[model samples]
Target: MRYAFALAAVLCASPALAQQPTAPAPGSNHDARPQFDISTGVDFERGDFGTGAQVDKIAIPLTAGVSIGSVRVSAQLPWVRVTAPANVIAPTGPLGLPILVDPTRPATRTTRQGLGDLRLGAAYDLPVQGIVASVRAAAKLPTASVDKGLGTGKADYSVGADVAKPLGAVTPYAGVTYTMAGDPEGFQLRNSFSGQAGAALRLGGSASAQLGYAYAQNPIEAGEDDQRIVGGLHADVGRSLSLGVYGSGGLSAGAPRLGGGVTLGLKFGR
Candidate 1:
């Protein structure tokens, strides 16, 4: 009977020994995999810009990536809609195109729809024990119409690092990023910095949840800083397939009041 009890204990703990639960955020190690992933989602946000003026954006975004060993690469393409007061940018076309005018335009509301910027990024995981860390970098290309107020017409650069530690079924992580933007006419956008901190819980063998906070400094001179609370979940639905859903609530005036996204992915390798 004693031998039987010992055998049962070892069998029950063996599965747990093979895998540790971790968070599901990109750039964090809690749920890192050496695989290819393709996902898509739509996101929307509304913000009050003061004086009864408001702005809104809706975006459909897609991302594709592959990770092999310690290195990962990805790309992004987005379709976006922007609605703002004409005082910001007046409409010159039927498809919601924005035409930046002199200081004399009317304050009527205008809307524009177009492709957004394209993005390419990569990350490399460091060789470390216990806590895992990665170097991250990305670039945003001018793919959207500048006259339509969809893209900056210039490239943006970003670099950052993220670190995470997994403890049993939970993981905690943090990261910081710095972005450099190109200057456009009438706007002197500054280089900016942002930070993220989060914890993730593994619900079972195939699902996980995370809660976190993100803060970013304003890149435009007239823009305010943004801080937000974020939460997300990830689950496996079938062989080589998964789903992710995430949302954010703004903590500062610079952010949209509410925002969320969903992603379905096909994964390989891992």
Candidate 2:
């Protein structure tokens, strides 16, 4: 559950991303090592999931991991803020499992914030010829308060694989993930299939840019299909620190009309 709230300013590229390159392009395959990072960002979106509602969300995620050969393992703790039309029943959870209040009941004005589901995940990388293949798996814990509209209060899981080929400084990649969210409370959620593909271009030694598209099937029976175009840039400020900003616009009625985020990274032992 990403591409949070949408606001005019959030859609504008940030000045922080205007630095020189000191590292590889963000999101490109790289050597693994023990590291820790904390990312925080704000997003504002409208007409999310065809709810005809406006939303503002702030998310903070912290991750720490180590690599063993080509394997990497990490854990993430996430917190979020959500403000939505009380009548639309915006349910939320981690990654692909979003929860909503029982819509059959009368809705009220809603604004809530707190922890999202905690997650532990791992990834493996395999290089074949000039193409690199990768697989990832994660498990979500029921950590958020369902009454606060922060989560579905159920455990969830997802697994996916993708391959990428580097063509000089420009690399293209594609991948898909299947999410399984168990039923919680009175609602039954369907398993979701989502996919993403795009290309990333590294600019000199200090900056990189990327463009991509994402598609996801709604987990709810009547939920609208989710489709959007997303892109962003990353800039290295120094040897170990970088800044990133991204934005997305929906291509379908079921998706958010607009959404975006910014992230700051400080890499160690990379």
Candidate 3:
């Protein structure tokens, strides 16, 4: 089975509110300038992955990005550690989920640690009838070593779009993504589709909360699809710093049973 502890990693990095761009003030020049941000965080998750063997994973990801006008570009790289049965593979794809290569293979718990595949992404914002919309594209580079089971040893690509509408203190949003998987030796990974729907609620002051459901098609033919409930609370510290705490619970065997993590973000430029 494919366990999505890696999905928790992605949620920890980008909260729902963070993906919504702020509109510029009327006749303001600030929106035309460039803005930069950097973020880093550690995420941990443990699950059986439906293979009758425990799997634990830790990921430390560092990301940096610049936004010019309504366009943004970013890159992320993560150090990952995985402990699982020898039949399981670590950091299998773009989301860094571990895969159960062969459940019937002899079981020997082992640990592997190394750099994960690097991901580069770009997005463009579009405002339409009071709704914030954006289109995004991303590529995963085969930077991690396949021998160490840190990646698929092939590049992957994805495209997606998101839209959010703000009403008073609440914003409702939804997004869909399509990914083209790269086949590795002895494995035929299938393309997949994923989506999320959520709402962010303002809790007064500098804090906000969000809750969402995520679903994804399983790329492996033997596993069930992935489904989970994800939520988080985020707060701004002063002007440039922000912090968030998030968690997820799996609704299917293809996802981690339970996972949570914290993240810190810093903003620069303007």
Best by TM-score: 3
After superposing candidate 3 on the true structure, give the runs of residues whose Cα lies further than 4 Å from its correct spot. Answer: 1-30, 92-98, 102-106
When 2 and 3 are scored with lDDT, the better candidate is 3
Which digits, one per residue and each the tens of the lDDT, describe model 1 over residues 1-270? Answer: 000000000000000000011244333333354677776655555555222467676666667887766777878776778788654531111011112332454667788887776777777878777676778777767777766666557677777777777787877777676767666567676787766677887798778887777666666556666666767677788888777666666687654466665666687764
What digit string (tens of lDDT, one per residue) describes model 3 on residues 77-195? Answer: 87888888777765633342335465444467788888888888888776555667778788878887776666668787777777776687877767777778688777888887777
* Candidate 2 or 1, higher TM-score: 2
Query: What CA RMSD would you report for each candidate?
Result: 11.8, 6.3, 5.5
Which lDDT value does model 1 have at 39? 66
lDDT of 2: 0.57
Residue 89 in candidate 3 has what lDDT? 65
Ranking by lDDT: 3, 2, 1
Please provide, for model 2 over 163-221, each residue's C-alpha lDDT reduced to its tens digit, 9 standing for 90 to 100. 76668898776667787876887788888877767777878877777777767677787
What are the TM-scores, per candidate, against the unseen true structure?
0.79, 0.82, 0.87
Ranking by TM-score: 3, 2, 1
As a whole number from 0 to 100, the lDDT of residue 113 in candidate 1 is 85
Native-referenced Cα lDDT, model 1: 0.56
